[model samples]
Target: MIDLESGYILRPVNPVFIYFSLFCALLLNLLPIGNYGWVPDWLIVCIIFWNIHQHRYIGVTWAFIFGLLMDVHNSDLLGLHAFSYALVAYIAIAWQKRIVALSVASQALHLLPIFLLVALFPLLMHWILSGEIIWWALTGAIQAFIEALLWPLATRILLAPQRRPIDVDHTRPL
Candidate 1:
């Protein structure tokens, strides 16, 4: 499909590539990097990328499953990450059309708020349950900015696989 707005012709995405990317993102998130508030959530970034570009294949259900896995890995309250992931997935889906139409740079601007909500959901939930706010968690907002900043680069990398060959041949007309 040729994106009329972006002028990029994209071939059908390989299911294998999608799964591999998601798995890699999950592994990255599961790495033993201490709970650093500024570290961007690689899994969610991957999820959002697919949500915007391949929503039919990657949706909220996938997000929930990845969230649950992270919850187990982190040994945190079960379903907390699941809920946050699903919430962000839903938001991304809701705005997928608009996000898809924008330039990659503009798309980052739209994602900033979605990232903010994802970053804050955990802290808000924790405060409500424990009645003690973890002020350090507030720094997680920085992760959102970092993710937004990297959006353009991420888009280029993720879309690279699907971009049609620039030199069209009669044998392959995408």
Candidate 2:
């Protein structure tokens, strides 16, 4: 079983953790499910975590790439998720300092709008490109709510301390 708190690997700052998280996000995205009332946006959750903690390593480019992968996997318009994810990444990076400092509860509150924007962007794009408004707007809204609810838990998991043994010096000559 992978450690949900410390991620799948032992190395704290390893790029592999990011890659693993992204891969898991993609897997979660592709999980087969018949039309659901609300499906949590797993990729966005993962993206937010990495962007908040590893902004220097994972930025807009990484978001774009993973978003494009999502596009290919889901067989949606090529640039739809790509653009939305990149925009979210940009926003997250722009607010990284504030986000990093926020309490988990506050971060969840902040994530509500971010997830709403993520949901809205795709719906708006689909309407514009297909010239048909999807009736699932309500469903998407609910999914955004679910995503927001999941944010604090996800953040706590992602930000958990990596060191297994807290080092302390117990020996001294007095």
Candidate 3:
């Protein structure tokens, strides 16, 4: 029987690490990659990764705040990132258990659709709001693919510590 209850034991996580990582993601997103039109949404990637690992605790609020920051940094429409990240957060939170149950690669596969949806939401919203079909918006598909490709690598790097036994002093008996 698969022991689903045997989730990894973890040490108390410092919230600072999460915030610092988000800050790093913001910095990454600010890099000059606009010429490709498929710039990775670093903050969304981080938000979704954490939402999978931390579930509801890392949900809509973080998404909204970071999205707003991203919008300001990128000088896009004000709520573009906000709406996209919030929607993605809700999806991630809703599917957290099922996705987290899978191995990292499987999780990345499942996340592909979610990432694509997130990439397209803002474009769809802009089309509706501006009353014009944004042809260039289709580039979001490439952006989604890039983000999906990144999920497993980012998950492995960030969650590696969670998968390992917490370092303990051997002299102390449990």
Candidate 4:
């Protein structure tokens, strides 16, 4: 019984959806696209989806937790992904209104630069930590391409069900 337009909650947040999103994001992150780096950033895609749909609640904390989990799962330098993801989550929340309102195609187009930055974050972190610029140019390009291509489809999938109205009866009392 949530109002999509106003984002007013008539009931508690759907825990099922929340946890499902989290699990899906984690799985997406774990998918073995390869160590080469052409794989799309599926977790970030999910993060953007939740951040756009549930901005008020899915802020930096969730990002931090997910980022930490990603660090552990990928066995990367701790806090690097977490820091970048937290920043991205914060940005997504800040722009949720504008983002959610845009057409899916537009959203995909907008994600181009954002995904580029996301791709760069890890590379930048590695450089800072190890002082070596990993030559991931090809992988970064491919990832950006995949992310841009998948944005519209992912947004549609996440938002389609939520767009439907749920039945409510004013005569009923909790």
Candidate 5:
């Protein structure tokens, strides 16, 4: 039970939570939701939250690794998602303090551009490789908006284990 007197979590954050969450996100993205104009980037949000709050455990490296995995899963060009994830991680790290200090709504506003760029990375790569513009680029804009809106919910759920209640000890039943 959490002690109200002193705020501390008895259990430390588990790597399993991180890994499992990331894996689950990958699975969710792979679900048959391709028809939706705006599927959220679940893994990216989790990665950024971890890097921002627990940089030592999760950082750009995790982003790159999982991103590559995502690319492979998506069956698109390899390293495309990896490179984009790494870029977003780098940007998130650089602005983490500022972003974290803001309210969730404000955070979305600040992060929208970053997410927009991430969502656009694939489209940009397509243009460079195929020399053809995709009308689907418009969908990326909607995706960015949805991603931003999800920031608060994702942050709360993913970071729950890390936010522990206070710890209190009593020698005799004070």
Candidate 6:
């Protein structure tokens, strides 16, 4: 009996906030710690969040650009991150209406597969290139789980600025 309906009525999101959040996420992803298996891709998380919540402002193009930046930062295969990011963005946008209506936990469950795909891309690419499947690459599943766990928190924080005050007073029109 999970509730698909969201309780809050959010105001229009500010374009500036979206950009600032994306910038912060990119900076976070650039941190050296991000390369570790324990750290989920912050940029990808933000990109998916925006794609699901604010499709008009953020889309596949943004994901591709950020992915390219990450590729350069990691010096990994060119377009690897870009392609995965674009794929994630496209999926999120495609499911935007259904996802937005779900409870945060439900949304996380729905997003798990997309995150897994993104996490496994590197391992998949490596296997394709070297003709060897690395069992250690399963650790990427941990990162995918972490990303899924982060969805509720991300939804809470990112939507805070736009949420209408709980205690609506006559003094406030909005």
Candidate 5 weakest ten by summed lDDT: 1-10
Give the candidates in order of lDDT, highest first.
1, 6, 5, 3, 2, 4
Each candidate structure's TM-score, on Cα atoms with residue i matched to residue i, is 0.92, 0.83, 0.84, 0.80, 0.83, 0.90
Q: What digit string (tens of lDDT, one per residue) describes model 6 on residues 96-156?
A: 8889777888899999999999999988998999999988878889999999999888877
**What TM-score would you give candidate 6 relative to the actual structure?**
0.90
Top model by lDDT, which number? 1
Candidate 4, residues 54-165, lDDT tens digits: the string is 7656778888898899889879889978988898888878877776667777777776777777778888878888898888544776787788899878765665555554
lDDT of 2 at 18: 72
Evaluated against the true structure, the overall lDDT of model 2 is: 0.77
Task: Tell me the spans in candidate 1 whose CA falls farther than 4 Å from its real position.
Answer: 3-6, 166-174
Badly placed stretches (over 4 Å) of model 6 are 1-6, 164-174
Local accuracy of candidate 2 as per-residue lDDT tens digits, 43-62 = 98899778877887889998
Off by over 4 Å in 2: 1-12, 35-37, 161-163, 166-174
Clashing pairs in 4: none
Give one digit per residue, the lDDT tens place, for model 1 in 26-81: 99998898888778899999999998888899999999999999899989899999
**Lowest-lDDT window of 10 residues in candidate 2?**
1-10
Cand. 2 TM to true fold: 0.83
Candidate 4 regions exceeding 4 Å error are 1-13, 165-174
lDDT (0 to 1) per candidate: 0.89, 0.77, 0.78, 0.75, 0.80, 0.87
lDDT of 5 by residue, 1-174 (tens): 221223433356688887788788878877877735578888787887777766778889989998998898889899999999999999999998888667778888999998898888899999999999888676887888998999988866876776654454565333
Q: Candidate 3, TM-score vs. the true structure?
A: 0.84
Error of 6 at 97 (Å): 1.5
